[model samples]
Target: MTSVTARTEREVTRGRTRRSLVRRETWISAVVLLLPAVVLLLLLRIIPTVTAMAEAVPLGGERSPWSNFAYIFSDPSFLNSVWVTLLFSVIVNPIQIALALALAVLLTKHIPAVGLWRTFILLPIAVPQAVSAIIWLVMLRPDGPLNGLASAIGLPTVPWLTEPGWALISIVIVCSWVGVGYWMTFLVTGIKEIPSSLYEASALDGANGWRQFWSITLPGLRRPLLFVLVADTVSNFLVFAPVRILTQGGPQGGTDLLMHNISERAYTLGDTQAASAATLVLVAIVIVVVTIQFRMLPGKED
Candidate 1:
């Protein structure tokens, strides 16, 4: 009986040892798998941000450690760029998300040739933004295809890229054209994941399309819509390609977004310090905006 008890104890010990070995191996494997991504994140994102902060610091002879910030804040062009970037964000983010949601809802129906239509919408995403801007540049010219079509339809040929108001609007249009489809793709996926029974049940209760959308679709799409909102906001704030290729900051400073202003400061004006400062400012603004979005959006915990 004592030998039997000892044998049982020995087997339990062996099992625990095996379990411990398996756990250790699992931990090591997880570390190995995660190392590459951690290294890349540190190298690509964290290091560059730290370098920008370092470069934004004042020189030895400066009045304060914030001289770069002071310099940019005092400049009217920089102030204008800040305002313009904010305005652009305000205009573009909502328009993109709204149109994206609209298209997502429309396309999720049992419409014929839905795949072909989706391809046409998402085609712009496959094209590079700079290339897309160039295409828009030609089309937006005074006597280009857009204007010719307007004339053929007996509408006035609007100065798309020339006037200040229209130049900013043109930037918004170009950005929306690229962004809406991309955002819609995510929304469509979220919509599809919603249980079909919920829609059917809602319909049986006499809910129409709009009512069903509000009760079923919108609630189901909360997470993806939040993601799209935050990402679209950040992308619009960083808009530079269209502004650069089409307007070059424009007839006035209408489309002079912060990124373009930072590039101009660093390269055109040879003020790397100011550009770095502006970059930090842009980062701070994005952080604040994203934080607000997180708080506002309902999450799983909510």
Candidate 2:
């Protein structure tokens, strides 16, 4: 019996050893396959970032390293652009996330023509942003269909794109129209991943729809919500085409966002160094805000 037990132990040890060797070889093969792509990613991302940072620093005898940054801060138009970008981000991020969440929840319900409605909701995402901006520009013009309808209804004929304040609001509407559907897809996917059994059990416990949503859906969507917030904030910060095509950062520079300002600096004024500095500022803002979000968002520690 002792000899039989010893033989069994020897076989088990040999099996573990073989499995370890196979796992090691598989890991090595995977790394070997992935190394090229990893190197390319670093070359594309890190090298450009380092180069841009170096360009931003004015390396001369008289100029300070932060001279570009100083010039940007001193420029009134640039300051206004920063403020517009921040205000736009603050307003649009919540609206988009909330609207997307609401739509995602509604779609998950058994409404009539549900699939068709979802298709209609997502159709805006398929339209290119530039095309959408042009369409919106036509509609929001002073003599456009929207104003015509307002005139018929005796509502005031308001300026949409011509004015500074209205242009920013119009831009927000356009962004929400284009972005909510895309964000909704992520939320719907997240909601679907949650087990239905939880809802069923909650219903049995006399929990209503709102209660279930608060207790289950909201908690289930922490990661997805975080992703949407960060991504949407970044996208909104970098919005360029609509402002360029519609407002051109006009009406006293009201809609002059960060990206538009950066482009104007880089392309129009031939100030690549200033643009690089502005890019760094934008990158820093994104990093700090995203880091704060990461810390504040719910997790296992919380």
**Highest lDDT scorer:** 1
Residues 101-190, candidate 1, lDDT per residue (tens digit)?
Answer: 999999999999998999899889889999999999999999899999999999999999999999999999999898899999999999
Model 2 gets an lDDT of: 0.92
Off by over 4 Å in 1: 1-36, 59-62
Q: What does the lDDT read for residue 164 in candidate 1? A: 92
Model 1 residue 248 lDDT score? 97
Can you give the lDDT of residue 216 in candidate 1? Answer: 92
RMSD after CA superposition, every candidate? 2.7, 4.6
Query: Which 10-residue window in model 1 sums to the lowest lDDT?
Result: 56-65
Model 2 stretches astray by more than 4 angstroms: 1-40
Residue 131 Cα positional deviation in candidate 2, in Å, after optimal superposition: 0.9
- Give the per-residue lDDT of model 2 (tens digit) for 1-302: 99999999999999999999999999999999999999998899999999899989968748899999999999998899889989989989999999999999999988899888888989998998899999999999999988999999999998998888999999999999999989999999999999999999999999999999999999998889889988988888889889999899877898998999999999999999999999999999889988888888876545
lDDT of every model, 2 decimals = 0.93, 0.92
Per-model TM-score versus the true fold: 0.89, 0.86
